[model samples]
Target: MAPVSLGVLASGRGSNLQSIIDACRRGDIKAEVKVVISDRQDAYALKRAEKHGIDAYYINIKDYQDKAAYETKIVELLRRYNVQLVCLAGYMRLVGPTVLNAFPWRIMNIHPSLLPSFPGLHAQKQALDCGVKVSGCTVHFVDEGMDSGPIILQACVPVYDDDTEDSLAERILEQEHKIYPRAVGLFAEGKLIVRGKKVFIREAGND
Candidate 1:
């Protein structure tokens, strides 16, 4: 079967993007990153895409007049690349319904903390502030809400007493790098099923 073609949105270093790219290269995932887009001009994901010979572009939200206009413009870019899957890799922008309505369940995102616990920014700090012993990362299907979507997979990492927010985030980020690619591979292989608010992962023997 042909690999699922991806269009990833990013805003920063794109460590997750590199993971996806590596997964595809190693044949650990049956997917192709077709294009990468970022709102930030200096985003390293663009350079990484260029190094990988993938199409890359930038569309500034500031240049756009409104959020709706910005989202519409992004949707057009995704369409231009024939993107079948949309991955949000550290994209800071809150997407309007224009793109969400366009992709529906086809979009996936990796959130910093276990969702339904900390849904907004500074999630690692939220976990530390709330004094939770357990904190982790989540890969979920993107909905219109802030991190309120059907979860695909979650890997738990314990929080320690001596850990600061930055340290805890670093631990969670390691787990994020592990699972995000797996989640995308599962989706590409037709092994992940979403029913209502629940997610089903097929036993793929450590895939």
Candidate 2:
């Protein structure tokens, strides 16, 4: 079978993007990153993609008139790559209707906290402030709302009493690296079925 083609959007160092790239290369995930797009020209994610010989693009958000226009251009880029899936790795922008409507449940994102919890930025600090004993990462299908999508896979990390924001985040990031690829792998294998707010991962070859 042909590998699932992925269009990855990122805005920072792209550690999760690196994890996905590594996963694909190791055959741990039945997918290939077709292209990478970043809103910032200096984002390291673009460099990561280029290093791997994948086409990388930098779209200037300031040039677009509105969020819709910005997302429309992104959608155009993704379509050009014939991307089968969209992954957001540390992509700071909230997804707009244009991209959401284009991909539907085909989009995935890795959030730093066990979502429905610390959702937006500084999630680790949010978790630490709330005194939660456990903090983790969630891989979920992207929707119109912010990190409100149905969950696919999650890995928990114990929050130690002495854990600072950086410490908790570091542990959670490790889990994120593990699960994002697994969730994408499930999608590649046709095992992910979304019904309302729930995502069901079916047995391999049984679906």
Candidate 3:
């Protein structure tokens, strides 16, 4: 099968984006990053995409009159690049309905803490504040709600009693890098099945 084409959106330093790129290059994922779009002009994610000779674009939200217009432009670019999958890697803004309707369950995101627990930013800090014994990373299908999507995969890490926010975040980030690529690989391989709020993983050659 041909490699799946991916469109990535990021707003900050894109460690997860880098992980995907490396995974594709290493043949660990049957996908290729066709284009990268960033809301911030100075996003390092753009630099990372350009470094790998991938098409990178900066779409300023201010340039568009409204959120819908902004996402329409994004959808245009994604379609132009024939992007089959959309990945949000450190993208700060909430995804509007325009984009959601355009891709449906084809969108994916990686969250720092186990989702439905600490979402909408500062997840590591939230875990520490809540005194959770285990914090983890989750890769899930994107939905209208904040990190409320159906989970595809997760990796857990023990929270140390003396762990600071950054310490916990670092451990979660390591897991994020691993599982995010694995989740994308599953999508590229047509091994993900979404039903209601649950995502089922199909075994190889089962279909």
Candidate 4:
């Protein structure tokens, strides 16, 4: 079978992007990163993609007249690459309706917190502030809302009494690297089924 082609959008250092790249190279995920797009020119994710000989692009929002135009350009690039899946690795922009309609449930994002709890930025800080005993990461299908998508997988870590935001984030990141790729692998294997707000995993060899 041909491997699933992935297009990653990122704005930061892209540790999650690196994890996906590494997983693909190790055959741990039946997918290949076709291209990477960043909104910032200096993002390290672009460099990571280029180092692996993958196509990388920087699409500045300032270059476009509106958010819709910017996302339309993104959709164009994804289609050009024949990308089968879209992954957001620390991408700082909310996906607009254009891209959402284009890909539907084909988009995936890895959030730093057990979502529906802390959805936006500084998730670790939010968990720490609330004095949550357990904090974790979530891999979910992307929707129009901010991290409000249905969950696919989650890995929990105990929040120590002395844990700072950075400490909790560091531990959660380790699990993020592990499960993000696994979620992608499941998608590649056609095991994900979305029903209403729930995602069901098909049993192996069922199809």
Candidate 5:
């Protein structure tokens, strides 16, 4: 089977992006990262993509007139790569209508918390502050709302009594690396079903 083409959006260190790349390299996922794009010019994600011979782009959001304009440019970039999937690997920005309409359920994001509980920034801190006994990561379909998308897969980790934000974040990140690729792999295999706000996974031979 031909590999699914992916367009990844990321900010910061992009450890999750590296995980996806590593999975592809090992044939663990039937997909190829066609492009890696970042709003910030200095994001290490671009460097990681370059190292893998994948096209990397730094599209400055400030160059555009508005959010719509920025997302329009991103839509064009995805078109250029014939991207089948748009994965958010630590991308801090919320996706607007332009890209959402273009990709619809095709976009995916992995968040640092179990979601519906802690949706926005500093999720690890939120979980820790809330004094939750269990906290982890979630891979979900991206939506217009902030991390209010349908959950795909999640991994739970215990919140130790002495755990700091940094320590909890580090552990959740490990689960992110595992499940994000698994979610992408499911998408590549045509095993995902998104109905309303729920996501259902089909058996391998069902399709």
Candidate 6:
């Protein structure tokens, strides 16, 4: 089967980007990251893509006149690469309607908290402050709202009594690394279904 082609958008160090790349390299997922796009000029995700021989481009949100124009460039990049999926890994910008409409359910994000709980920035700290005994990460479809889409998958991490925000963040991130890739793999493999604002994942076990 031909692998799903992906365009990853990230603004940070690309740890999740690297995780997907490593999964692709090991054949754990039947997909390839076709390109990396960043709004920031100095994002390290570009370097990671270049190292893997994938096309990397920076579409300056500052260069465009409005949000529509900025998203137009993003869509252009996806079309240029014939991308089948888009992944947001720490790509701090809020995606507008243009990009969401273009890809539909094809774009996804990994948020640091079990969404519907702490939905925006500083989610890790929010979880810690709320004193949740169990905190986790969520992978979900991206909509116009921030982290307010239907859930795809989640992996929980226990919040230790002595856990600090940073420490708990690191732990939840490890789970993100696992579930996010699995979510993408399921999508690429035709194993996921979305109906009536809920996702129904087909069980793969031989029960």
Error of 2 at 146 (Å): 0.9
Clashes of 3: 0
Comparing candidate 3 with candidate 6, which one achieves the higher lDDT?
3
Q: Estimate each model's TM-score.
A: 0.95, 0.98, 0.98, 0.98, 0.98, 0.96
- Stretches of candidate 1 above 4 Å error? 202-207
Off by over 4 Å in 3: none
List runs of model 6 lying over 4 Å from the truth. 204-207
lDDT of 2 by residue, 20-62 (tens): 9999999999999999999989999999999999999999989
Question: What C-alpha lDDT values do all the predictions have?
Answer: 0.92, 0.95, 0.96, 0.96, 0.95, 0.90
lDDT of 6: 0.90
Candidate 4 global lDDT: 0.96
- As a whole number from 0 to 100, the lDDT of residue 127 in candidate 6 is 86
lDDT accuracy of residue 138 in candidate 2: 97
Please provide, for model 1 over 1-207, each residue's C-alpha lDDT reduced to its tens digit, 9 standing for 90 to 100. 999999999999999999999999999999999999999999999999999999999999898899999999999999988888999999998777999999988999999888888998999999988999999999999988899999999999999999998899999999999999999998898887778998888776743
Worst 10 residues of 2 by lDDT: 198-207
Q: Write the per-residue lDDT of candidate 3 for residues 1-207, one digit (tens) a residue.
A: 899999999998999999999999999999999999999999999999999999999999999899999999999999999999999999999999999999999999999988889988899889999999999999999999999999999999999999999899899899999999999999999999999999999997786
Q: Write the per-residue lDDT of candidate 4 for residues 29-124, one digit (tens) a residue.
A: 999999999999999999999999999999999999999999999999999999999999999999989999999999999999988899999999
- lDDT for 13 in candidate 3 is 92
lDDT of 1: 0.92
Error of 5 at 186 (Å): 0.3
Residue 182 displacement (Å), model 5: 0.4
